[model samples]
Target: MKKNLLSIIILALLVVNIGMTAFMMLSVMTTNSQTAKLISDIAAALELEANGGNTGGFSGSASGNVGVSNIATFGFTGDDQLTINLKPGSDGKAHYMLVEVVFSMNTASADYATLGTSESLAGMRELIKGKVTNTLSSYTIEELQADDGPAKEKILEEVQELYNSNFIYDVTFSSVLYQ
Candidate 1:
């Protein structure tokens, strides 16, 4: 009968469609799992957290939990903010940044007693400014703008080394403008 044959043909096509859909889903799921694993591996290798809180700038010798009560800040603002001429990028245009650098000192550290006060650190301000200038002027605008984490880490390291102490535990660019 023509009706019976047509029904059988339609049923066969539907069955094939269902089978193909299941196969495609299985293939896609396997690839998705593989991609997720690769991303996880890369994040772990870079010591990055999923929440993206830690930028690794305060790692190494200066890393520790300093309570808010034990923290002191010395900042460069207004006329004190640094104006750095950056290294030229591929575009070959001179770029500059106006940045305010702030140092977070650990008030509880022994070094703080000798060097952490505003008056004490002011004497070394020129030297610290030079270090910041040297670190920043070496990077091209593109490089510096891509991610500032490395630059901040380098400056923090140099400052700590300059004093031979970790009393200054963090450096922050509280304000910045690039042009």
Candidate 2:
């Protein structure tokens, strides 16, 4: 009789363990599905691809396709490099960034014919420098030091906005000095 009783107790515990496992699995699966749905919703809202492809950090304008032949580069170096006064950080000290930038423009754009030339670019030097200065000055020294991507992107966007076109598709900092 004791042997039978022991066997019954073992069977009961095994059944209970299986039931608890099923319950936990169902709970986890439900939560996981909900989280996945949330991520999909957010991605769709942002117009992001689910495959997670990178555009090589170059965001093309218009048709979202840029060819090598369509690219034109304008650079600021030497005396033309921007020396910007950055915003004060937590330490309340002044900071500066000396940055040499290069702009990759879409030569296929209509504005490119008007503004993409070296002489035309030189004529608009102050506007370009002002955009760079305003954008860089908004960031604290520490923030700018952490990652240069955001600053470059902001400058590109501002330049695009200034001209009411995305003729300038990319901005690169060939050299940077922070002090």
Model 2 compared with the native: what TM-score?
A: 0.69
Best by TM-score: 2
Clashing pairs in 2: none
lDDT of each: 0.84, 0.81
lDDT of candidate 2 over 22-118, digit per residue (tens): 9999999999999999999998755533212244222335435579999888878878888889999989999999989888888887778987888
Tell me the deviation in Å of residue 97 in model 1.
0.6
Please give the clash total of every predicted structure, in order. Answer: 0, 0
What does the lDDT read for residue 7 in candidate 1? Answer: 100
- Tens digits of per-residue lDDT for model 1, 1-179: 99999999999999999999999999999999999999998987655432223443334433456899999898787789999999998999999999999988989888899999778798999999999999999988898789998898889889988988778878889898999
> How far in Å is the alpha carbon of 130 misplaced in model 2?
2.2
